[model samples]
Target: MSDAMTLREITDFAENLARKAGELVRREREDNTLRTDYKHQTELVTHADVMADEFITGAIRKRFPAHRILSEETMPDLSQAEELDTPLWIIDPIDGTVNYAYGHPQVAVSIAYAEKGQVQAGVVHAPFSDETYRATKGEGATLNDKPIQHSGATEPRQSLFATGFPYTKDKLEPLINRLNAMIHQCRDLRRIGSAALDICWVACGRLDI
Candidate 1:
Protein backbone atom coordinates (compact mmCIF):
# COMPACT_ATOMS: atom_id res chain seq x y z
CA MET A 1 0.00 0.00 0.00
CA SER A 2 1.07 3.58 -0.57
CA ASP A 3 2.62 5.39 2.40
CA ALA A 4 -0.08 8.07 2.34
CA MET A 5 -2.89 5.51 2.33
CA THR A 6 -1.21 3.52 5.12
CA LEU A 7 -0.78 6.61 7.29
CA ARG A 8 -4.42 7.60 6.75
CA GLU A 9 -5.57 4.13 7.79
CA ILE A 10 -3.35 4.16 10.87
CA THR A 11 -4.62 7.58 11.92
CA ASP A 12 -8.24 6.54 11.55
CA PHE A 13 -7.71 3.28 13.44
CA ALA A 14 -5.89 5.10 16.23
CA GLU A 15 -8.70 7.64 16.65
CA ASN A 16 -11.35 4.91 16.68
CA LEU A 17 -9.50 2.74 19.18
CA ALA A 18 -8.78 5.73 21.42
CA ARG A 19 -12.49 6.63 21.47
CA LYS A 20 -13.42 3.03 22.30
CA ALA A 21 -10.94 2.83 25.15
CA GLY A 22 -12.08 6.23 26.39
CA GLU A 23 -15.64 4.97 26.59
CA LEU A 24 -14.43 2.04 28.68
CA VAL A 25 -12.64 4.48 30.98
CA ARG A 26 -15.82 6.56 31.38
CA ARG A 27 -17.92 3.51 32.18
CA GLU A 28 -15.39 2.21 34.67
CA ARG A 29 -15.29 5.60 36.37
CA GLU A 30 -18.93 5.23 37.41
CA ASP A 31 -18.72 1.56 38.47
CA ASN A 32 -18.27 1.53 42.24
CA THR A 33 -17.27 -2.11 42.07
CA LEU A 34 -14.19 -1.48 39.94
CA ARG A 35 -11.03 -2.43 41.81
CA THR A 36 -8.04 -0.16 42.27
CA ASP A 37 -4.50 -1.45 42.69
CA TYR A 38 -1.04 0.05 43.00
CA LYS A 39 1.77 -0.55 40.55
CA HIS A 40 4.13 1.42 42.77
CA GLN A 41 4.03 2.92 46.27
CA THR A 42 1.54 5.58 45.16
CA GLU A 43 0.84 5.04 41.49
CA LEU A 44 -2.73 3.83 40.92
CA VAL A 45 -4.04 1.30 38.46
CA THR A 46 -7.60 0.19 37.86
CA HIS A 47 -9.18 -2.80 36.15
CA ALA A 48 -10.32 -0.38 33.49
CA ASP A 49 -6.72 0.44 32.65
CA VAL A 50 -5.83 -3.16 32.04
CA MET A 51 -9.10 -3.80 30.22
CA ALA A 52 -8.50 -0.87 27.91
CA ASP A 53 -4.88 -1.89 27.34
CA GLU A 54 -5.85 -5.44 26.50
CA PHE A 55 -8.62 -4.27 24.21
CA ILE A 56 -6.26 -2.03 22.22
CA THR A 57 -3.45 -4.57 22.10
CA GLY A 58 -5.84 -7.32 21.01
CA ALA A 59 -7.20 -5.17 18.22
CA ILE A 60 -3.72 -4.23 17.02
CA ARG A 61 -2.55 -7.84 17.06
CA LYS A 62 -5.56 -8.99 15.11
CA ARG A 63 -5.31 -6.22 12.54
CA PHE A 64 -1.55 -5.83 12.33
CA PRO A 65 0.10 -8.84 13.88
CA ALA A 66 3.50 -7.83 12.60
CA HIS A 67 3.58 -4.61 14.58
CA ARG A 68 5.02 -4.34 18.08
CA ILE A 69 3.15 -2.94 21.07
CA LEU A 70 4.53 -0.97 23.99
CA SER A 71 1.88 -0.17 26.57
CA GLU A 72 1.95 1.40 30.03
CA GLU A 73 0.10 -1.56 31.55
CA THR A 74 1.71 -4.40 29.64
CA MET A 75 5.30 -4.23 28.56
CA PRO A 76 6.51 -7.79 28.12
CA ASP A 77 10.01 -6.71 27.17
CA LEU A 78 12.00 -3.69 28.22
CA SER A 79 14.93 -4.02 25.88
CA GLN A 80 13.28 -3.18 22.60
CA ALA A 81 15.27 -1.08 20.13
CA GLU A 82 14.74 2.67 20.03
CA GLU A 83 14.52 2.50 16.25
CA LEU A 84 12.43 -0.48 15.25
CA ASP A 85 12.21 -2.08 11.85
CA THR A 86 8.51 -2.77 12.33
CA PRO A 87 5.79 -0.37 13.35
CA LEU A 88 5.27 0.24 17.06
CA TRP A 89 2.08 1.19 18.78
CA ILE A 90 2.71 3.05 22.04
CA ILE A 91 -0.42 3.15 24.17
CA ASP A 92 -1.56 4.66 27.40
CA PRO A 93 -5.01 3.17 27.85
CA ILE A 94 -5.78 5.51 30.72
CA ASP A 95 -3.48 8.49 30.78
CA GLY A 96 -4.69 9.70 34.19
CA THR A 97 -5.46 6.65 36.31
CA VAL A 98 -5.50 8.56 39.57
CA ASN A 99 -8.03 11.00 38.20
CA TYR A 100 -10.03 8.20 36.63
CA ALA A 101 -10.15 6.33 39.94
CA TYR A 102 -11.42 9.49 41.58
CA GLY A 103 -14.05 9.95 38.82
CA HIS A 104 -12.27 13.05 37.56
CA PRO A 105 -12.82 13.99 33.93
CA GLN A 106 -9.15 14.76 33.21
CA VAL A 107 -8.44 11.21 32.08
CA ALA A 108 -7.88 10.32 28.43
CA VAL A 109 -6.91 7.50 26.10
CA SER A 110 -3.63 8.05 24.19
CA ILE A 111 -2.42 6.10 21.18
CA ALA A 112 0.53 6.85 18.94
CA TYR A 113 1.95 5.06 15.92
CA ALA A 114 5.71 5.17 15.50
CA GLU A 115 8.15 3.74 13.01
CA LYS A 116 11.93 3.93 13.40
CA GLY A 117 11.33 5.81 16.66
CA GLN A 118 9.45 8.63 14.93
CA VAL A 119 5.81 9.23 15.72
CA GLN A 120 3.79 9.37 12.50
CA ALA A 121 0.27 9.51 13.84
CA GLY A 122 -1.44 9.92 17.19
CA VAL A 123 -4.88 10.22 18.76
CA VAL A 124 -5.94 11.40 22.20
CA HIS A 125 -9.57 10.95 23.24
CA ALA A 126 -11.21 12.68 26.17
CA PRO A 127 -14.49 10.90 26.74
CA PHE A 128 -15.80 13.22 29.42
CA SER A 129 -15.55 16.21 27.09
CA ASP A 130 -16.44 14.15 24.01
CA GLU A 131 -13.35 15.49 22.30
CA THR A 132 -10.95 13.69 19.99
CA TYR A 133 -7.59 15.20 19.04
CA ARG A 134 -5.66 13.64 16.21
CA ALA A 135 -2.47 14.33 14.30
CA THR A 136 -0.36 12.86 11.55
CA LYS A 137 3.20 13.80 10.69
CA GLY A 138 3.28 16.82 8.34
CA GLU A 139 -0.53 16.99 8.53
CA GLY A 140 -0.85 19.36 11.53
CA ALA A 141 -3.45 18.64 14.26
CA THR A 142 -7.18 18.77 14.93
CA LEU A 143 -9.56 19.00 17.88
CA ASN A 144 -13.05 17.49 17.63
CA ASP A 145 -12.47 17.27 13.86
CA LYS A 146 -11.68 20.97 13.59
CA PRO A 147 -8.20 22.25 12.84
CA ILE A 148 -6.47 23.82 15.81
CA GLN A 149 -3.48 26.08 16.42
CA HIS A 150 -0.96 26.63 19.16
CA SER A 151 -1.19 29.64 21.46
CA GLY A 152 1.99 31.13 19.88
CA ALA A 153 2.61 33.30 22.91
CA THR A 154 6.32 34.04 22.93
CA GLU A 155 6.46 35.77 26.31
CA PRO A 156 6.48 33.54 29.38
CA ARG A 157 4.40 36.07 31.28
CA GLN A 158 1.63 35.70 28.72
CA SER A 159 1.73 31.91 28.55
CA LEU A 160 -0.51 29.65 30.58
CA PHE A 161 1.45 26.50 31.45
CA ALA A 162 0.13 23.05 32.28
CA THR A 163 2.03 20.26 33.96
CA GLY A 164 1.67 17.16 36.14
CA PHE A 165 3.69 16.15 39.15
CA PRO A 166 4.97 12.70 39.93
CA TYR A 167 3.03 10.76 42.56
CA THR A 168 6.04 9.66 44.60
CA LYS A 169 7.60 12.01 47.12
CA ASP A 170 11.14 11.18 46.09
CA LYS A 171 10.55 12.71 42.66
CA LEU A 172 8.52 15.65 43.95
CA GLU A 173 11.36 17.87 45.06
CA PRO A 174 12.81 18.52 41.63
CA LEU A 175 9.40 18.96 40.06
CA ILE A 176 8.53 21.43 42.77
CA ASN A 177 11.69 23.39 42.06
CA ARG A 178 10.80 23.51 38.36
CA LEU A 179 7.27 24.58 39.15
CA ASN A 180 8.60 27.28 41.44
CA ALA A 181 10.80 28.62 38.70
CA MET A 182 8.01 28.49 36.13
CA ILE A 183 5.43 30.09 38.38
CA HIS A 184 7.57 33.21 38.64
CA GLN A 185 7.89 33.49 34.85
CA CYS A 186 4.54 32.30 33.52
CA ARG A 187 1.09 33.78 33.89
CA ASP A 188 -0.22 30.70 35.75
CA LEU A 189 0.08 26.98 36.08
CA ARG A 190 -2.35 24.08 35.99
CA ARG A 191 -2.07 20.43 36.90
CA ILE A 192 -4.65 18.74 34.69
CA GLY A 193 -3.76 15.14 35.80
CA SER A 194 -3.34 13.72 32.27
CA ALA A 195 -0.22 14.34 30.21
CA ALA A 196 -1.98 13.50 26.97
CA LEU A 197 -4.74 15.98 27.71
CA ASP A 198 -2.18 18.59 28.71
CA ILE A 199 -0.45 18.14 25.38
CA CYS A 200 -3.75 18.31 23.50
CA TRP A 201 -4.59 21.49 25.35
CA VAL A 202 -1.26 22.95 24.27
CA ALA A 203 -1.99 21.98 20.67
CA CYS A 204 -5.50 23.43 20.68
CA GLY A 205 -4.51 26.69 22.43
CA ARG A 206 -5.94 25.80 25.84
CA LEU A 207 -2.44 25.92 27.33
CA ASP A 208 0.65 27.73 26.12
CA ILE A 209 3.19 25.25 27.50
Candidate 2:
Protein backbone atom coordinates (compact mmCIF):
# COMPACT_ATOMS: atom_id res chain seq x y z
CA MET A 1 0.00 0.00 0.00
CA SER A 2 1.08 3.60 -0.57
CA ASP A 3 2.45 5.70 2.31
CA ALA A 4 -0.46 8.12 2.05
CA MET A 5 -2.95 5.29 2.34
CA THR A 6 -1.11 3.94 5.36
CA LEU A 7 -1.23 7.34 6.99
CA ARG A 8 -4.96 7.59 6.36
CA GLU A 9 -5.45 4.18 7.88
CA ILE A 10 -3.53 5.17 10.96
CA THR A 11 -5.60 8.32 11.26
CA ASP A 12 -8.84 6.37 11.04
CA PHE A 13 -7.62 3.89 13.63
CA ALA A 14 -6.68 6.65 16.02
CA GLU A 15 -10.06 8.29 15.58
CA ASN A 16 -11.90 5.08 16.32
CA LEU A 17 -9.79 4.40 19.37
CA ALA A 18 -10.39 7.87 20.69
CA ARG A 19 -14.14 7.49 20.26
CA LYS A 20 -14.18 4.17 22.07
CA ALA A 21 -12.09 5.53 24.91
CA GLY A 22 -14.38 8.53 25.13
CA GLU A 23 -17.37 6.31 25.53
CA LEU A 24 -15.65 4.31 28.23
CA VAL A 25 -14.84 7.39 30.26
CA ARG A 26 -18.30 8.89 29.83
CA ARG A 27 -19.93 5.68 30.89
CA GLU A 28 -17.68 5.37 33.90
CA ARG A 29 -18.61 8.86 35.01
CA GLU A 30 -22.33 8.38 34.38
CA ASP A 31 -22.31 5.17 36.35
CA ASN A 32 -20.41 6.71 39.29
CA THR A 33 -17.71 4.09 38.93
CA LEU A 34 -14.73 6.46 39.03
CA ARG A 35 -12.10 5.67 41.63
CA THR A 36 -10.45 9.04 42.04
CA ASP A 37 -6.96 9.49 43.35
CA TYR A 38 -4.19 12.03 43.35
CA LYS A 39 -1.05 11.68 41.28
CA HIS A 40 2.11 13.10 42.93
CA GLN A 41 -0.23 14.58 45.54
CA THR A 42 -1.53 17.10 43.00
CA GLU A 43 -2.89 15.85 39.70
CA LEU A 44 -6.10 13.87 39.67
CA VAL A 45 -6.38 10.32 38.33
CA THR A 46 -9.23 7.87 38.12
CA HIS A 47 -9.90 4.21 37.44
CA ALA A 48 -11.40 5.25 34.15
CA ASP A 49 -8.04 6.67 33.10
CA VAL A 50 -6.30 3.34 33.46
CA MET A 51 -9.15 1.46 31.83
CA ALA A 52 -9.17 3.78 28.81
CA ASP A 53 -5.39 3.75 28.51
CA GLU A 54 -5.29 -0.03 28.58
CA PHE A 55 -8.03 -0.27 25.99
CA ILE A 56 -6.33 2.17 23.63
CA THR A 57 -2.78 0.84 23.98
CA GLY A 58 -3.88 -2.75 23.70
CA ALA A 59 -5.79 -2.08 20.50
CA ILE A 60 -2.87 -0.20 18.98
CA ARG A 61 -0.40 -2.94 19.88
CA LYS A 62 -2.60 -5.59 18.36
CA ARG A 63 -3.24 -3.65 15.15
CA PHE A 64 0.29 -2.21 14.77
CA PRO A 65 2.79 -4.25 16.74
CA ALA A 66 5.71 -2.20 15.47
CA HIS A 67 4.36 1.01 16.96
CA ARG A 68 5.69 2.40 20.23
CA ILE A 69 3.26 3.71 22.83
CA LEU A 70 3.76 6.64 25.22
CA SER A 71 0.58 6.65 27.18
CA GLU A 72 0.04 8.74 30.30
CA GLU A 73 -1.05 5.88 32.51
CA THR A 74 0.86 2.67 31.75
CA MET A 75 3.84 3.64 29.59
CA PRO A 76 5.07 7.17 30.28
CA ASP A 77 8.74 6.63 29.80
CA LEU A 78 9.99 9.12 27.21
CA SER A 79 13.74 8.68 27.70
CA GLN A 80 14.15 7.05 24.27
CA ALA A 81 11.36 8.87 22.51
CA GLU A 82 13.65 11.19 20.58
CA GLU A 83 15.86 8.45 19.11
CA LEU A 84 13.13 5.93 18.38
CA ASP A 85 12.93 4.81 14.75
CA THR A 86 9.32 3.58 14.77
CA PRO A 87 5.86 5.02 14.72
CA LEU A 88 4.75 6.25 18.15
CA TRP A 89 1.34 6.59 19.72
CA ILE A 90 0.96 9.27 22.37
CA ILE A 91 -2.16 9.07 24.45
CA ASP A 92 -3.86 10.87 27.31
CA PRO A 93 -6.65 8.65 28.50
CA ILE A 94 -8.35 11.43 30.39
CA ASP A 95 -7.16 14.93 29.62
CA GLY A 96 -9.17 16.60 32.36
CA THR A 97 -9.06 14.22 35.25
CA VAL A 98 -10.09 16.83 37.78
CA ASN A 99 -12.95 17.94 35.63
CA TYR A 100 -13.95 14.35 34.99
CA ALA A 101 -13.97 13.56 38.69
CA TYR A 102 -15.96 16.67 39.45
CA GLY A 103 -18.55 16.01 36.74
CA HIS A 104 -17.42 18.83 34.46
CA PRO A 105 -18.07 18.49 30.78
CA GLN A 106 -14.68 19.58 29.43
CA VAL A 107 -12.84 16.30 29.67
CA ALA A 108 -11.40 14.50 26.63
CA VAL A 109 -9.52 11.51 25.30
CA SER A 110 -6.45 12.58 23.33
CA ILE A 111 -4.61 10.38 20.83
CA ALA A 112 -1.82 11.17 18.40
CA TYR A 113 0.37 9.21 16.02
CA ALA A 114 3.83 10.41 15.24
CA GLU A 115 6.67 9.23 13.03
CA LYS A 116 10.20 10.64 13.35
CA GLY A 117 9.04 13.20 15.91
CA GLN A 118 6.38 14.71 13.62
CA VAL A 119 2.76 14.08 14.39
CA GLN A 120 0.92 12.47 11.46
CA ALA A 121 -2.57 12.26 12.94
CA GLY A 122 -4.43 13.32 16.07
CA VAL A 123 -7.89 13.06 17.59
CA VAL A 124 -9.45 14.76 20.61
CA HIS A 125 -12.80 13.34 21.65
CA ALA A 126 -14.99 15.10 24.22
CA PRO A 127 -17.69 12.63 25.11
CA PHE A 128 -19.55 14.97 27.39
CA SER A 129 -20.31 17.29 24.49
CA ASP A 130 -20.24 14.56 21.85
CA GLU A 131 -17.65 16.47 19.84
CA THR A 132 -14.75 14.92 17.98
CA TYR A 133 -11.89 17.00 16.63
CA ARG A 134 -9.48 15.35 14.23
CA ALA A 135 -6.64 16.30 11.94
CA THR A 136 -4.30 14.45 9.63
CA LYS A 137 -1.07 15.94 8.45
CA GLY A 138 -1.62 18.04 5.30
CA GLU A 139 -5.34 17.22 5.31
CA GLY A 140 -6.53 20.09 7.54
CA ALA A 141 -8.67 19.76 10.67
CA THR A 142 -12.31 19.13 11.50
CA LEU A 143 -14.83 19.18 14.36
CA ASN A 144 -17.44 16.41 14.20
CA ASP A 145 -16.23 15.76 10.62
CA LYS A 146 -16.94 19.32 9.50
CA PRO A 147 -14.04 21.52 8.43
CA ILE A 148 -12.89 24.08 11.05
CA GLN A 149 -10.73 27.16 11.17
CA HIS A 150 -9.51 29.72 13.67
CA SER A 151 -11.43 32.85 14.50
CA GLY A 152 -8.79 34.99 12.70
CA ALA A 153 -8.91 37.76 15.27
CA THR A 154 -5.68 39.66 14.76
CA GLU A 155 -6.32 42.15 17.53
CA PRO A 156 -5.68 40.82 21.00
CA ARG A 157 -8.14 43.25 22.53
CA GLN A 158 -10.96 41.78 20.50
CA SER A 159 -10.04 38.13 20.95
CA LEU A 160 -11.23 35.62 23.56
CA PHE A 161 -8.59 33.37 25.09
CA ALA A 162 -8.67 30.00 26.81
CA THR A 163 -5.95 28.58 29.08
CA GLY A 164 -5.23 25.96 31.72
CA PHE A 165 -3.07 25.84 34.84
CA PRO A 166 -0.83 23.14 36.20
CA TYR A 167 -2.02 21.01 39.07
CA THR A 168 0.99 21.98 41.17
CA LYS A 169 0.93 25.30 42.98
CA ASP A 170 4.56 25.70 43.90
CA LYS A 171 5.39 28.24 41.22
CA LEU A 172 2.25 29.93 40.02
CA GLU A 173 3.51 33.49 40.14
CA PRO A 174 4.57 33.46 36.51
CA LEU A 175 1.33 31.92 35.39
CA ILE A 176 -0.64 34.43 37.40
CA ASN A 177 1.33 37.29 35.88
CA ARG A 178 0.68 36.00 32.40
CA LEU A 179 -3.01 35.64 33.14
CA ASN A 180 -3.13 39.18 34.46
CA ALA A 181 -1.55 40.48 31.28
CA MET A 182 -3.89 38.47 29.10
CA ILE A 183 -6.94 39.66 31.02
CA HIS A 184 -6.01 43.24 30.18
CA GLN A 185 -5.10 42.57 26.55
CA CYS A 186 -7.83 40.17 25.58
CA ARG A 187 -11.57 40.64 25.49
CA ASP A 188 -12.03 37.82 28.00
CA LEU A 189 -10.36 34.74 29.43
CA ARG A 190 -11.70 31.27 30.13
CA ARG A 191 -9.93 28.81 32.39
CA ILE A 192 -10.92 25.53 30.85
CA GLY A 193 -9.57 22.61 32.86
CA SER A 194 -8.96 20.43 29.84
CA ALA A 195 -5.95 21.39 27.73
CA ALA A 196 -6.99 19.15 24.84
CA LEU A 197 -10.41 20.78 24.70
CA ASP A 198 -8.85 24.21 25.02
CA ILE A 199 -6.74 23.67 21.91
CA CYS A 200 -9.69 22.16 20.07
CA TRP A 201 -11.75 25.19 20.92
CA VAL A 202 -9.05 27.44 19.55
CA ALA A 203 -8.88 25.44 16.33
CA CYS A 204 -12.66 25.48 15.89
CA GLY A 205 -12.93 29.27 16.38
CA ARG A 206 -14.64 28.97 19.77
CA LEU A 207 -11.65 30.65 21.36
CA ASP A 208 -9.22 32.99 19.60
CA ILE A 209 -6.12 32.36 21.66
82-113 per-residue lDDT for model 1 (tens digits): 65677788999999888888778888999998
TM-scores of all models?
Answer: 0.93, 0.94
Best by lDDT: 2
Clashes of each: 0, 0
- In the range 68-123, model 2's lDDT, one tens digit per residue, is 88887557456767677877889999998888999999999999998777788999
Best by TM-score: 2
> How much is the lDDT of residue 11 in candidate 2?
78
lDDT of each: 0.87, 0.88
Residue-level lDDT for 186 in candidate 1 = 91
- Candidate 1 minimal-lDDT segment of 10 residues: 74-83
